[model samples]
Target chain A: MHSDTKAPLALKLSAIGGLIFLLAPIALIFLYAFTTEEKSYQFPPPGLTLKWIGVTMGRDDVWQALGLSLKVAAIATVLAMVLGTLTAAAVARSRFFGREAISLLVILPIALPGIITGISLRSAFALLDIPFSTWTIVLGHTTFCIVVVYNNAVARFRRTSGSLIDAAMDLGADGVQTFRLVILPNIGTALMAGGMLAFALSFDEVIVTTFTAGNQSTLPIWMLEELVRPRQRPVTNVVAMAVVLVTVLPILAAYYLTRDGAETAGSEK
Target chain B: MTSPAIFAPRSGVLARAADWAIRHPRMFVFLMVLPIVLWLGIVYIGALIALLMQSFFSIDEFSGVVQHEFTLKTYAELLRPSNFAIIARTVAMAAAVTLASAVLAFPMAYFAARYARGKWKALFYIGVMLPLWSSYLVKVYAWKLVLAKEGILTWIFAQLHLSWLLDAVLAIPVVGGNSLSVSYLGTFIVFVYIWLPYMIIPVQAALERVPAPLLEAASDLGATPKQSFRMVLLPLALPGIVAGSIFTFSLTLGDYIIPQIVGSGRLFIGQAVYTQQGTAGNIPLAAAFTVVPIVIMGVYLWGARKMGAFDAL
Candidate 1:
């Protein structure tokens, strides 16, 4: 807030440069999506067209992958919300034995590198005879997704004073009534923010999905395969541009709902 | 956020159960925690334990079947020079990325934390989150295109008469390659690009929390601006820096797809693990390989925690 603390000219320039470095590649996706050159990248397109969008839309496999990703993200988000809210509700007020370790356990999925989570879940599936399927992907996603919800929910739960619940109970409300009238409204936006963030993570997850998806293709896995083996390169860019636009909505929603604007950052890794 | 209408005051058995759960706080807590404990503890922790166990089991070199008996064979494989090189390469790249990310992130984080107000702050956040929420694979793939020999970066350098500079850099030994897309340098660029936001958000957050008065206090004590920054700001922001580096470093260490898409044919730890488990059916070896990052991140996090990074995180 002080004049002396203002960033110098060099610092301001570097900040702009840094932002450009981050945003330029995302801009490149949109550029290439309109490129007429189908097979390889060129510095500037020989020509420009919107035909790849139509071509990508025509691909059946693309539709299937999109459908699968939506389904998995939806299921994972719901499961994360349930488990995360329960854990938060229990953990927010309790100082039970091993509480620190329990909190660590809750965070472990997001804390460790995703590869560890991926392979561990892959092995556990083999050990337990769970078939590689949509449900398998959902489980892998839910493991990490829970932490996002837990992070958001627990913070809100802590902030929502104990007096509100007590006040509701003293006013002759039953347990369900107190929960419905008092607790739900207080924590609803936090849970919404958490669920939205969870959905975004699940929708775009690739590394963990790589291990658990077996032969199935979520949208990210499909995009990865397409990049590795390009059938129509421009189409991939088009699809990527579309994915970026679609996923942006949920992230924006999460940012909007969280009371602390930066709350969505809690489990971003 | 769901309807939860099932818990509505309906009737007999369900009503009694709800009433009972409400009456006993401890019992309610136990019941509430039961599903989470089972899901995280049994399913998630059980999976981790399974991985650790598999790392102790060896593979049959002849039949290709996994041997159930406990052995040091897989961990031994990790010590083999070829496998050890992969670990070293991944760790080196991870370190470089984290360092570069912190350097690049700091100025932006500083600007955002100190000077940006209202709409500009919102725009700064959106800039970070847009890249993050966008498809991870797509971002990596975009870099591949951008760094291709025929890509715009080359075009820009050519336009600026800097083609010789790029060629000179590309002529260097290991980090160089036929093109930027296939170089170790390229892998480093992509890693730094993708993980920079992870670093910025934390560092910006940490910086924002340090009151302006702290800086004024240092200045008021006759400290030069540079001295105040070194003495007062850096230590205060260390935790946030460490928190961000943990993500950048760990993400770089464990990523397979970036190297697969953009780097030279050399294997990173992620690729090694992926191939061993996915293609070669060497489950034990793959599990053992994973232990490298787990151990590295574990030690790094422990060190970071001691530096108070947990507060920033």
Candidate 2:
């Protein structure tokens, strides 16, 4: 807080450099999407064109993948919100045995490697003979998405005054009425923020989806396949630009919704 | 006013049930927790255990069918020199990326937490998070293009007449190669770029918590700024650094896509698992390979919990 305690010039420069390093690759994604060269990545593109946008729009496969991705993300987010809120209420609002272990169990899916989750789910599905469909992808996604929503909801639950619930009950309100009239309003924004964050995460998820989605191709899976086969390269980049915008909006919205709260959804304590 | 008791008997069944639920808190808690426990505990953790069990089963070398009997043969196969190399290479790269991210993230996190104010602070925060919100695959592909033989880096080096420098660097032992796109250095760089934000946020969060008075007291007690930073700031921020490393390290260790797109066509644990299961039809070996990251993270998380890293998380 003192002038003498200010960060040095070198430190400031390093910070700026770090930001640039973080952003430059993303900038390249936007830049290459408009490149005239369709197949090859020529450094200084001989020219720039918007033809790739038209090409991307014309592809039915892209549209199909996009539609599937939206469906999966939406369903997964809904499941995450319900189950995550319930878990949060139970863990944060009540004292019980095995609470810490339950908390750890909830967080494990996201904390561990995605590949581990993927393979385990794959093997489990095989073992149970559960057919891989859109629902399977949703099920795989709910595991981690629940962690996101749980973190946000639990933090909000802990922060809300316990006396408010007690007072509602003393005044003859039942549990459902207390929850609907008192608790929901308190945690609505936190739940919405968590759901949005979860949706964003599920939308871009590839690793787990790869293991769970047997035949269905989500947008990222399509992109991965397109990358391997190479048909109209710039078109794939254009679709990537679309993916960026789609995912970024929810994340930014979640940020604004939770900005006043003590904790953000993803960076939970 | 009408007496409220008049409405009590008239209440719907749902309201009565709610009242009953309120009276039985333990039952309510159990009901609330059942779905998640079923999903995360029974389904997810159960799957992990099943996978681990698969790892212990032996795979018939001839028919490639999993025998399902308990045996360490699948794990013993992992000890073969080629398979062991993949594990060693992946761990080394994960360590290198974690170290690099922590070093790079610290100064930026320090500046944002200590020096930046108001609008500048918000901008720094968004700058770090925006990239994370974007497509992970796109960023990795962008690096793939950037590090390609005829890509931007080569062009820039050529413009500066430093192409020979890049060539010489690429000529070094295991890490060096013909081009950045197919070399170990390229994989390491892209891995760091992707996971940098995960490291920055926790470090910034940790640094923001260091009480201003602690630093002031150190300086007021006649300690130099450098000495204060070394003694006070670093110790306090260690947990945050450890927290960030957990994300960076585990993410890198589990990633198959990045190495597939950018690195030399060498096997890493993720790739090995993917290929073994998907192509070779060797579920036992794939399950065994997945355990490498699981075990590593188990130990890493235990150490992190000891350091109170979850507080910063």
Candidate 3:
């Protein structure tokens, strides 16, 4: 807070430059979505139009891919919420052998490279005769999705006072009643935040999905295909704009919900 | 009336089970954790083990089918000069990206942690996080457009009458080419842009923990600002830097999409593994190649854990 401790003008200027570097490409994506050019990227488009939005909306394939991505993310978020809540309850509320190991195990899915998870899941499915379907994609997604929920829930659970449960028990409430009335309300926002973040993560995932989705194209996979093999490129940019909207909103919501909670988690250290 | 019903036994089996579980905390914990352990352990870890095992089994060169018998032949093949070059290139790129992100991120992280306050702080954080929220593929592809022959970078260089600057840089060996879009430099720039936020957040977190008194104390003790930053701030922030690098390095190391789209068709570990397993049908080699990043990250994470990096994450 001291004036003497403040950053120099040059440092602030460079930070502004860094922000521009980060955002310029995203800004370009939005700009080009309205460009009239369909074949190649023109620095200064000759014309701008809103017609690509209409075209993108009319495409059945885009709808199918978007629907599949939403379904997969929803299912994966539900799975992560249940399993991750249980994990947080156990690790945060009770002492156990191998607890740290379990935490590490939970984080491993996301901590290791996505390609490793993709390759492993791909082979494991083949070995077990599990066909690559939407279900397969869900399972693959749930692996990393669990980590996000676990991190959030565990932090909130730790911040929750154990004495609340004891107080409820002393007041003649049963376990279910204590959980339903006391514990649930305390961690509800945390779980909601975790679920939203998990959903966002699952929605944009491409690498693992590439391996686990046999013939299926999630929104990201479709976007990748569209980029690699060009066809009416502006249409893909329009779809990208939609994706940015869908994913960014949930992430912002999660940030607001968790911003206060983060201090208690001591993750800032 | 409610007290009378409270003592009554629940009619459903599930309700009785809930009653039993609440009374027995240990068993409750066990029951609560069993499904997750089974899912993560049997399914996820089991898959990883299976993949590792596949690496040991050899592929028949003639039939292009993976054999059940164990062999070290695949590992030996991975040591070939071309394969080694790919490994070296990927690691070098990862290191370079990590360094670039850290250097670029530190000043911003410092400014946010120490100088900015209240709404300014919140705006800075939002700026850092906004890019992370956007689609990763879209960002990479956007960079593709920006670096294309007739894209924004070229347009700017042409306007500046310095078009030959980029051309001269592109004229160099392996890492360069005819245009920015097809060069390793382009891929490096995009990688740094994508992962910069990861570095900034952790570094900011670490800097936030450094007390104002500590810096003031250093100044009081006759340390120059630069000296105090080098001696005090850098050491304090080392764990966070390591934590951030863990994300950037591993993410870059295993990414195939950026290289596939932006580079000059140079093979990274991810692309090689994808091609080997998907196209060539050589499962063993792919598995063997996959082991490289796993081993590298295993060591990196172990070191990071020693530095107390997980707490920051």
lDDT of 2 by residue, A169-224 (tens): 88977788899999999999889889978988898899999999988999989988
List where candidate 1 sits over 4 angstroms from the true fold. Answer: A1-7, A93-100, A249-269, B1-10, B118-120, B210-228
lDDT of 2 at B150: 73
Model 1 has an lDDT value of 0.87
**Candidate lDDT values, in order:** 0.87, 0.86, 0.86
Error of 3 at B229 (Å): 3.5
lDDT of 1 by residue, A206-236 (tens): 8899889879999989998887888778878
Residues forming the 10-long window of minimal summed lDDT in candidate 3 chain B: B1-10
Task: State how far residue B141 of model 2 sits from its true place (Å).
Answer: 1.9
What is the fnat of model 3 with respect to the true interface contacts? 0.63
lDDT of 3 by residue, A44-152 (tens): 7779999999999999999999999999999999999999999998999899887888898898888778888988888778878999899999999998899889998
lDDT of 3 by residue, B1-313 (tens): 3446547777677778878887787888888889888878887799898888888999888887789998999999899999988899999999999999999998888888888877766668667777877889988888988998878889999899998888889988877887888898988999999889889989988888888888889999999989998999899888889999998999899999988888888899999999988889887888899899989988988989999987776
DockQ of 1: 0.58
Please give the range of 10 consecutive residues that has the lowest summed lDDT in model 3 chain A: A260-269
* Superposed model 3: Cα runs more than 4 Å off: A1-6, A96-98, A249-269, B1-8, B23-27, B213-225, B306-313
Candidate ranking (TM-score, best to worst): 3, 2, 1
Q: Candidate 1 docking: what grade? A: medium
DockQ of candidate 2 compared with the true complex = 0.58
